[model samples]
Target: MKRNYMYIVLAYGLFLGWLLSFPYNGPVLKHLVLIHQVPIASFSLVYTVVPAVFLIIYLLFFQIKEEYAKNIMNWSITACIVGTVILFTLPTYYWYPVLAVMGIGSVMYIIGWSYYYTMEIPIDEKMRIMALVIIIGNSIYYVINILHDQISIGFLLAVIIVPLIGAFRATSNIAVNNKIAVELEHEPLPVKLIFVICSFLFAVNITDGLTFHAIYPSFDQLFVEYFTFYGIMPYIITLVIIFFFGTKLSIMFPVFLGTSVLGLAYLSFGLMGKNWYSYFITETFLQMGWALLDLVLWTLFGLIASIYGRPLKICGYAFLANLLAVFAGGLLAVRILNKLDNYFIISAAFAIGIIFISFLIVPWLSEAIEKDLRNKLFKTNLQNKPIEEISPLSIPLPQREILTPREREIAELLIQGFTNKQIADLLHISENTIKTHTRKIYSKLDVANKRELLQLSFSSRMSKGRSS
Candidate 1:
């Protein structure tokens, strides 16, 4: 607990420094203050794009097999180092190190969340105290500016102090706040920690990128932004907002966050900034649209996760639901975005290609956001929901009759109300075996006669046909 607190403090301090640089405030801003100088955008290379790639790598590799502690830690540290170096280097990326430290805190928060919920361990007070110290220390930088005449930095520092404090406290003490979570047990800490940092990095990058851009149009990389999942991220993030809290009520969180992000993007593109309007518009649209869709889907994730007796079933349904929605949404988007960008006919092909590829990702965003929304909406309470659009009565797993594959096929046919001779004809099996198998099936199903056992089977088959 105390250890984490220390991390929080450092995160806060880092945030303070980054925030001060947001307005490009230095010792001489008073003579010539430029609000449009969003120095933070330069960090996008290190914070947003680079981390995005690393995360993809982490997920892909981590999912393949169990990642050992040594490997996970090595990669995690490597990622942090490379990210830090890039941030510390080029003028455009200098903001990296400044924000990266605080990004670490965000990662810690995720670790805390996962540990507290999934692993179910008691809070470590020591880590909490350390985090508290870091949080306070980070704020001290701001406090210094306030007392020392702004050093020309007073205003900028003040703007950052609050968020820094929150980040510190949340990141450091977060894990210590909770005492029990089983899910943490199986989770690879290194991999989870990497993504946690990523979440924060994305948050800061998105915030800084959009904020600075609003002040003044800058950068040529926006073509990539628009062509990427830029518009859809807000919706993707909506899932986390909802999931953080959990449940139906939590669903509102994504909407709230999505709305705010959209509003900010709108202000940046519509009223304040120019240059990257197309990309911003697309990103804003995806963000808001994902939120709307999340409200619908996350509720379902909650129901599916909780009510389905089988975990695999939960995954299966989730996969199918999102598959259908994404397929529908993707095909629909290709047709629409092409028409929407009709004015730019020369670049229409490029835009259309990007649109098609990006659409596939919507399923993930929609599914994720749905989970977040569900988590948030019902944070305070569990709500019964539509697990399935039509909740069909489920038959328990068929009795393990110890039948061979071919025998099971025969059984399935018989269960469909086929006569023994008909079942034999379908499977090219002899009638004598069909009869013998029927007797065996009835015996296994514990029916004194064929009538009772096959009665349930026939009823189930007929019902399935009717539903179909």
Candidate 2:
């Protein structure tokens, strides 16, 4: 069963990789532009915007019930297959509609599969699984690029179909329960944390848009001329890094490293000028940096979804932010940056500024996110404990008046299993302050340890229940 699950994940990862790499590097979009006379910008806009719209709809109104998961997945995949066929065979007039269908289908399929996977998989294993999926998915695209000059329609069909079959067989018998959803209703959404994350993503992607044209003359130029050395090799190095260190490091490390490398890439373009050697150097760093950021983006969303138990909504909002940022960035790059005399230098400076800001801000962001997760876990642990384990005190808890208001707040968290450091993080105070508060809380409650404090708390609650 576990092996089958792994296969399903890998299959989806490969498709995801193809989605990420092919439109930019492979012949699909280029063929549409060269043969079918579809404008590159039009196709890009439809594909990007349509998915964003779908996510908006999903977030605002649509809810996927557990009973319909399989059907939604099946229909989404079918739509994608049909859209692919339309892209190949339909008239140029049908291109926009085809792209829209593909976009909507892709969003539905990705979110459906991802939500189910996150819900079913254990937390400890998720990071490693995500890393493997990313590596395989990306590696497959690069491998195909190396091996085939023109990917046949039949091969593309197989790529989509084979994965669909494997995923269906693996997940067909499984039933998802609504228990997590019910639990999620009780936990408040961490609005501040979500805002921070989305804002960071928006900033990162916008800069990517601003610098995109400066780095590559066109998408085809990168893969067509330097497919082997500059194109594939840098990504290979990135894959190796992700495979080895991705799961081992703190999540924020990648965010910092990726932004820094991106800064360097932009800096290279600014200093060295646009030539083959410079493009090679810039592209290498860009690929490595972008790959890391992409990995972090997906992983972070997955973590948020798992923690909140609202996978579709969380993932939907994240994708929406990403799409909008890319669109906004691309627009600015074309309209504003390209008109400037020193485009590369200005873009590089913007990127460098973003890196420095991230260095200053990412530590706080990491702590805020960590504090939320700790708080959630503390609540979950308390809820999941057996009733008998929460032994009631022979006497009631100490009177609330015994402690100051601040110490009362600290006592509540302490009884709820928050560590001193976690309390400090949550309350935005120093660890030393938390320790001082803890000592006062212990004195006021007449408790020696956390276990006794918890007992008194439970007893107080039970006593109130009996009296009322």
- Best candidate per lDDT, number? 2
Give per-residue lDDT, candidate 1, residue 149.
38
Best by TM-score: 2
Q: What is the lDDT of residue 194 in candidate 2?
A: 75
Separate clash counts for every candidate: 56, 0
Cα lDDT of model 1 by residue, 1-468, tens digit: 345434444443354343333322221221122333543323323333343343344334533211122232234333433443343334433444644543432332222222222122122222222223323432343343343333434444444444444544444443333322112122122323223223322322332323232222233454643422243345434444443433334333343344344444434443333366545564565455435433433233323223221222222223333323323333333434335533233223332333343344435544654554354344313112322222223332256446665556666655444556656655667999888887887777767665676676667668777879
Candidate 2: list runs displaced more than 4 Å.
4-8, 21-26, 151-186, 218-224, 392-414, 417-468
Runs in model 1 with CA error above 4 Å?
1-41, 60-152, 170-180, 183-468
Instruction: List the lowest-lDDT window of 10 residues for candidate 2.
Output: 387-396
- Model 1 reaches what TM-score against the true structure? 0.35
lDDT of each: 0.38, 0.70
